[model samples]
Target chain A: MADELLEVTDLTMRFGGLRAVDALSFVARRGEITAVIGPNGAGKTTVFNCITGFYRPTGGGVLLTHADGARFALQRLPGHRIARRARVARTFQNIRLFAGMTVLENLLVAQHNTLMAATGFGILAVLGLSRYPVAERQAIERAREWLDAIGLTERADDPAGALPYGAQRRLEIARAMCIDPVLLCLDEPAAGLNPRESDELNRLLLRIRADGCSILLIEHDMGVVMRISDHIIVLDHGRKISDGTPEQVRADPHVIAAYLGEGDEDEVPAEEVVA
Target chain B: MKSALRDAVLSALVALRPVPVAIAVAAVFVGRLLLLAWRGRSRAAARHANRAFAERLTQAGKYVAPLLLIVALAVPLSGDRYYLHLGILVMTYVMLGWGLNIVVGLAGLLDLGYVAFYAVGAYSYAIISTTYGLGFWTCLPIAGILAAIWGIMLGFPVLRLRGDYLAIVTLAFGEIIRIVITNWVSLTNGPNGISGIPRPTLFGLKFTPAGGPGSFSDFFHLPPSPTWRAVYLYYVILVLALLTNWVTLRLRRLPLGRAWEALREDEVACRSLGINVTVTKLTAFAIGALFGGFAGAFFATRQAFVSPESFTFIESAIVLSIVVLGGLGSQLGVALAALVMIGGFEVFRALADYRMLVFGAALVLIMVLRPRGLVAGRTPTVALGRKREISAELVAQGRG
Candidate 1:
């Protein structure tokens, strides 16, 4: 855990009587892909919300340590403060692209805080006296780079809602990337993709990981989970059931029992371990 | 066979209708031709073509303003007082629409209390000029600042509200302001309002009689006609309107402006991007109110009178309609909408009994045919190559 970018300890979230997330703990290492897989209603998303400050945890802490030795207690911060101050970014399960804005503007808006400061909170910029032009030029360059990586440079001027489903998912990732996040949390980035699109998503995630940004993904596809994840954690009924490297988690009896049938775990075949 | 079928259909229509067969046949032929014409071009293709045309128009935006300004300046040359006053009224509405556009169009705030800011500006000028004896130039900025302060005050409580709830609160705020002014007898003179407000001077020269040494007509060495003041008022409002347009255009390209648009699209997404949603919303209110203040000050000076009756809920509704009917976030659209809506009403003034009915019908037709307004698409603040128009179909409407 020396290079851990995010550490969750005993994170608990209670919605009235229902414990959506209970005592969940995990560490996401920098520059690596960490995936959380669980059955339906296992509260994988609740854990993400706790870490991203969308929901206040009933108990436990979420600690994020940056490369420069700075640390943030994400649980104590507001949602926007978590993203802005802690440099953590996330994509929604349902795509939340700025539908009225163009594909490029959506990415540009992600860098809003940076550009707003450069313009002296818009006073000097509106008057044409600030370094806003320089900042704007840099932002456009960065947006273009991301657009190229996502293969959406041609449709940069088109409205974001007009993009195809696969393209919108990629654009959401790109928009999240534009925030210059230290930890990128994607909620089912592969959710509605075809096999080919999922393969493309895998390549994109790998490239994003290679850029030294840690990725925390919540996905249901086991093929995607086993193929790309460097580390995997499984949860059941808001409890962390298994945590280890891919092979170890894949072979764990608890994970197999949770995936197959809870009582008939003995009937599982040896060959199914690879699945 | 086709002719037989058409004839049969025409005969059937004649039988069912208390109509002549000749008229039915003609109506059927026209309807079929129109349907075929419409079906000939795909909707997607038509939308793309319309967007391209809009793009070209926006590309020429720089020239459009100055050309309009030239025409405005040329209006007083015609020397028609009625037309001149109409132009001034239209310009006032245009300024009001532009101000509200910042809040409703860009920031996506549903503010029904926008006219409250306008009232603040007008009253600020009226009260100060009457009591303190300040000139128009001195009170203009002060009025704007005061209105902006009121804007921030109003913005604070509503920061947590959204959609219809936000709109209801704003509507209440507008009514509250009007009620307070009406009952505030000592300071505001109640329903009677403040009167005998000082008129603006042309560099310390009044537009009054030549008996005064530095009167405007004396300075120009022309016979003093009331048209001098009318023309002066026209130019002043024109300048003020242009300033409003200029500032709004500049802000649209600024970082704060983009934040407003982003917030409009999705507040949760905006906050997730680390944008200060509170500041964004407040600034929209303040800036929008600032312009409303300026326009208000001008209005008071032009009328030389102030009354609570002038600041009503209907004014807020009209301004809101201008922003919506102009297409959200489009400056040229707002101006054009103000002109068409306001100017259209003025042109039908001769048929005073039927004026409101005609106005209502036209508005209904606009809502049905162009629900997105005259110019619905927005040219992106930043883009590569030619900027593309974001179609109104892409936006969630009627909420704000």
Candidate 2:
């Protein structure tokens, strides 16, 4: 309980007659990579949406505990405040970079609150009276560091939309990291990456985890989910079917059935079916 | 290609029966030749051409600003009252275009009711100065603040809307303000209009012919002339317009301006990055109205009258067109657009009955040729290394 970074209890989201996520409960420990994977419509994204404050769950609580033991009920906060106050950052299933803005600007926008405060909400900066120049230089320096980390340093001035698909995916993660989030929620980060790019992503994500930030990932790529995730939560029909370490969840009968369909599970191993 | 050219020429001929036929034919032929040249190029070659054009535009822009400033400063020396009046009008529209650019261009909020604020500013100056006997200098800031409050009032209800829906609400707001000024008899005089507004003075020195203790002629010991008043008013509006432009340019480099462009690019992304969308939108609206109010105050003092007829839906449409035709967020483009639109309107006065038709045709032609307006490229606010001008193709035209 002391190591728990996020605690989602009885999370329920209903759209009229359909239950997108029903009474799903899970806990992501501090500084660990927790993967949430399921079949096409197993409500994996719904769980993420609820945690990120994109969709207010019909009934439930999302409690995030900061390192200093500060508690924030994510659902009660507004969308932007979830990122600002709760330090929860997320990337969309479909990439949503400020495609028109330059790579550096995209990262700078992530640190908007910090610079805004330093600039006295624009008054001081306009009047050339604040500590904004120093703050801006530091912000740009941090952006350059991330750009280097993602191998996008040369293209820092180019529009984010102009980057290759794999690079864009990496940049999205880098943008998310720029916020210095306590928790990073990625929705299907490895969706369309090639094998080589996927491998690179594994290293980048590992680097992020090693930096002491907790990760909550929704990935369909079994290779990525199984390889990097220290803990895994499997969902079926908006309910948690399996929750354990990678091997334990991989060997569960319910997770296999959810992926491969019911009653033919004995013929093929879960690895081939899920992967 | 030949058939398409023929069709274009045929349409132009049909549309311009009142004008000279040779001019229309020449225009079509030149357009066709350019299109053919463009189509014959390879993809790489086309991209090269685009880059070269953008570079040349930038090169020219560096010199154009100073040149234009010199020309503007010399207009008062010409001693032509008509040209001075025209300069004042163009500068007013330029200020309006820049103000609206913050909303519809940068923040991407379509505001069709901008003139409502303009009307509020004019009325504030008119009623306050007339009733309270305050000078223009004293009433100017009050007018701006009052308009900003009205801006905030309008911003609240329309915060949830976007695109066409937002445009409709703002359009209705413009009409509502006009209707209010029309019917509010006790306050606005109910369409009878307000007149005899005071002219601006030089530090309390009235521009009067009779030499006295508080007259401009007496203070300077110069012969009094009516042209001096026109020249002074021209310089006043010039300073105000420049201030608007300078402040806008400075804001673009700050966090607030970047947030506006980011909001335009994608509102959902702005929220995900911890940007307060409500405050950003309201600030853009309020700031834009503040400038509009300043221009309105100037207009009241210049004309010495305030009327509901002057602040109509057409005025809003014209200002919005100037922003669009000026290529949205580009400050230089907006100023150029105001010059062309306002100045060209006067230039076509000889045609009398056909002036509107010619103006409409010219607008259509410009839209067809340059879909992104005159200056389509964007300069990035901040850069990690050498700053690059974003190509027009890469810039996102906000939902407006």
Candidate 3:
């Protein structure tokens, strides 16, 4: 039962001759905000995909060891299995809500598989069967709770697509919470947010950590990262260039040159060469 | 088609059957009113839920109440032979529509050769019962097995193909089966069609030979009743239709069902969630075809003949249409769509040559009117206890 929630080791993914993510390793601690930041094609999202099981890695392993010392080989797990089995939940850069369904249904559906287990195939659930009502009530309660938290209770019955961009982002978070994830991975959650919305998002993130949740977020906003992240990992062209606290990363010349823009279009880092 | 409408109207005149479903609906309304009253008296949360319900009631009543009124009108209207038979055909499509809905609509798997499984079931029954002298009851299981197998077989190659291409391949597969059935006369009697196929006896009665012990005529002591056998056929189909509903409702609530909806929304997300999209997709295909096969077998037996003409591409389109019109992933909606489309088409057969034109125009109108279909899906509006209404205050608290 250690505090290390996720461990990624030597993870690499290749596309033709290009290595999208090459030899990257990091440990995300439990109950903390771990920010992965790099320039536009830094393979940050790609790393998230590999760890969450969207893509099979070409090398290395991802071991998600819960507090109980239960090690889940995320590299071995497929995408959906990673979510359900490893309690790993994620949101996409592009919102992917069920367009045809109402907003409430989308969240309820995130808890779809589990409800079946509780309802025993919904035979009881639909029939108002034993303990089925309890589960159904609990699910509604959870969905309602999240909707309230996201300030979407008023629009609960509206189609998910009808929600404003900011609300949709919140709905996605609420939907992910409905799955009751152990580790939540967010890819650019603050990308399109206005200043006020981003501030609200920061509060939400802090509250999430307070409620005993671990978050791994990929962000471009240095202010948000430096303000909220307990740990920061910087990548450049699929390689982990720096891993440390925000202040440490901000101070590192390698990050300044590779990530913060230097005359390095032709220069390779000495540390990368040494490694 | 006019003849079919006549039959339905004449039949209505002959018999006024009690509609159990209509009564059940009325009962539900009464229960809801009582619920609304209980909700109004409770906590503030209950009142909010009640308000939502009151709003929903008005919106739904505008559409549903009219439809119910039309169905009620049919009770007093009887039908003649042709219209009655068309009525039966409409019922068959309801079954097929419901079947296809589970796969295409619910699971979001585009299956083009859906009719192929229907063919498998039909021919399995046709060749098995006629060739081996098996009884109607005996061939049903074999029909289901063969159809399911064909479904799985069709599922494999296309599991890799998606979207429009998947649709064409499936459509091609359905055509391939039909062509084989037409060319291979030795097995299917080719395009000549299988005739003298035995009707399914109730127990051991022969309907044609009226004096037989278990024939409808013998059982009812009616004199050589042709309509009696037809009525029996209708009930058989009704039972099968009910069974299909029960099974689908059961399946959709399972983990497999949830996996299916997930696959439909985002396959990548589904995989991320650890759902095996391949297995989920295939199971849907297999099960959907199984029902299609069951319906096809029943069609073959009821007609007492089999032919490629019955299993056409248009049939698949019609089934798909019903699913779309009903609203995807909504069981009750799909069934309602089937009843309306098939039933409405049959009722307007008096217009004959103009029927398709009118039907086409109506379809266009529907597309414009309720593009989501007549029975657009409505999610269960959640609310506080006994009140059954969503409490705004409660929801706000849930957000964090």
Candidate 4:
């Protein structure tokens, strides 16, 4: 509990009569890669939405314990306040990079709340009287660092949509990083990537973890999940089937049964469970 | 041998024709290039070249402001009173377009009743100047403040609505303002309207022909003509329009401005970025209305009259078209569109009956030819080292 960065206590999200996430509880440890893997309708993403404040949970609470010892009940905050106040940032499954903005601007926009506050919400900035120039220079510096980290400095000026699929995936992660979040939530970061790109994503996640950031990842790629995740949580039918180290979760019979349910093939192949 | 050579040349000419084949071939080539540009280049070299071209355009954009100002200043020296008046009118629309740009273009709010703020400004100035005996300068800021208040009022209801619903409510708001002014006889003089609104004086100096003390003619010791007032009014509006441009340009680079555009691109994304969406929308409305109010006051003084008829839904449509036809986020595009829309139409005034028909056709043609508006590229507010212009077509509307 001392190392727990995020605690989800009996989180439940119900849509009318349907319970998308029912009585889900888990802890994401500080400075480690914790992943949630489940079948398509198993409500893994529903947990992300609730924790990120995108969907107000029908019941239960999400507590985020910052590295500095401050705690925030993320469930009480709005979507924006979750990011601004709780210092938790998330990327979408569908790659929500600002398509019109340049790769560099996409990163700069992530730091918008801070920059706006630095310039006194823009009045002094307009009058040429604010400390905005210094703040802006620092923002650009941070954006450049991310651009370099993602190997996207060459395409920094290009429109984000102009990047190839693999690069866009990395750019989304880089953009979320620009928020300087204590906890980063990435939803299926390697969903469509080839093996090489998937390897690159694993390295990037490892590097981010090395920088003292806790990551809560939701992914389906078994190779990625087994390669990088320190801890794994598996869900089936809106309930947590198993939670443990990757090896433990990989060997669990319940997790295998959840993936290979009723003799119907799901996205996760049964044979890959061994590897 | 001579005949054979001549026959070959003749055959080539016949294949080419005078215009049709040549034009068709040229069109095909250009169409192919545009398709490639729209789809973007697969090769890194082509993208590099495109970036270079866009960067050059951004460099050229730096000089466009000063050049425009110089051209605007030299206009009055031509000594055509009619053109000066026309220039003033064009600048008025330029101000209105820039104001509405903040709302519709930057913030992505489809405000159909922007002219209501303009009306509030004009009426505020008229009532203050005529009844309270205030000067033009004195009433200017008051007019802007009043319109901005109305803008905030409009902002509250439409905060939850977006796109077409927001447009519908704003359109209704415009009609309501006009109707209220028309019915409020004691305050607004009803359909008769308010007239003899005093002209703005140059400090204490009047543009009177009697050549008395404190009159422009006596103070400057120049021959008085009716054109003097028109010329002075031209400069006043020019200054105001330039101020609008200056403030808008500066704001576009600021954090708030960037936030507005970010919200426009994706509201959900903006909220996730920790931006207060309500404050962002309200500021866009208030700032846009502030300029609308300023232009409205200028209109009242310029015409020496005030009436509900001037602030019709058509005025809103005209301002909206100016922003759309110009290209949404391009400041230079808005100004150019105002000229083409307002000033260009003046040239066709002799054909009065067919004037509107031509204007309508022209608008449709422009929209068809350039769906992203005339100036489609947006210069990004933040860049690494060198900025590049982003094609508007590449930008997804992002509601999905």
TM-score of chain B of each: 0.85, 0.88, 0.76, 0.84
Candidate with best DockQ: 1
The TM-score leader among the candidates is 2
lDDT of 4 by residue, B99-162 (tens): 9988988888888788899999999999999999999999999999999999999999889896
TM-score of 1: 0.89
Q: How far off is each candidate at the interface, as Cα RMSD in Å?
A: 1.0, 1.0, 7.2, 1.3
Q: How well is each residue in B1-400 modelled by candidate 2, as lDDT tens digits?
A: 1122223324433453535444544665687678768767775786677667757876688788788889999999999999999999999999999988888788888888889999999999999999999999999999999999989999999999877778778889999999999999999888888999999999888986565777888788888777878899999999999988988898888888989999988888888888999998999999999999999999999999998999987788788878877787888888888998889989999997566566655765766555566777778889878888777777777663
**Ranking of all candidate structures by their TM-score, best first:** 2, 1, 4, 3
Chain A TM per candidate, in order of listing: 0.95, 0.95, 0.92, 0.94
Candidate 4 wrong stretches, greater than 4 Å: A263-275, B1-66, B209-211, B397-400
- Per-residue alpha-carbon lDDT of model 1 for B1-400, expressed as tens digits? 1122223223323343333344534555676578568957786786677667656666676587677678878999999998899999999999999999889888888887888999999999999999899999999999999999999999999998877778878878888988999999998999998899888898998987433578898887888888888899999998898888888889888778888888888888887788878888999999999999999999999999999989987788778777777777778878878888889988998976555555555654565456676677777888876786677778644243
Instruction: Output the worst ten-in-a-row residue range by lDDT, candidate 3 chain B.
Output: B391-400
lDDT of each: 0.84, 0.86, 0.73, 0.84
| Candidate 3: CAPRI quality band | incorrect
Q: Write the per-residue lDDT of candidate 4 for residues A1-275, one digit (tens) a residue.
A: 33999999999999999999999999999988999999999999999999999999999999999878899999899888888888888988987777888898888888988888888757788889989999999998999988889999988999987899999999989888888888999999998999999999999999999998899999999999999999999999899999999999989978987877645446656665554
Task: Give the C-alpha miss distance for residue B253 in model 2, angstroms.
Answer: 0.7
Question: Model 4 Cα displacement at B369 (Å)?
Answer: 1.7
TM-score of 4: 0.88
Which residue pairs clash within candidate 2? none
Task: Please provide, for model 1 over A1-275, each residue's C-alpha lDDT reduced to its tens digit, 9 standing for 90 to 100.
Answer: 33888899999999999999888988888888999999989999999888887899999999999999999999999998988999999999999988988998898999988888899767777679999899989999999999999899999999999999999999999998898999999999999999999998999999999888889999998778789999999999999999999999988988988888554255677655555
DockQ values per model: 0.74, 0.73, 0.21, 0.61
List the candidate numbers ranked by DockQ, top first. Answer: 1, 2, 4, 3
In model 2, the runs with Cα more than 4 Å from the true position are: A263-275, B1-55, B209-212
Model 3 C-alpha lDDT per residue in residues B167-219, reported as the tens digit of each score:
77887999999999999988899998898676888887777744566566877
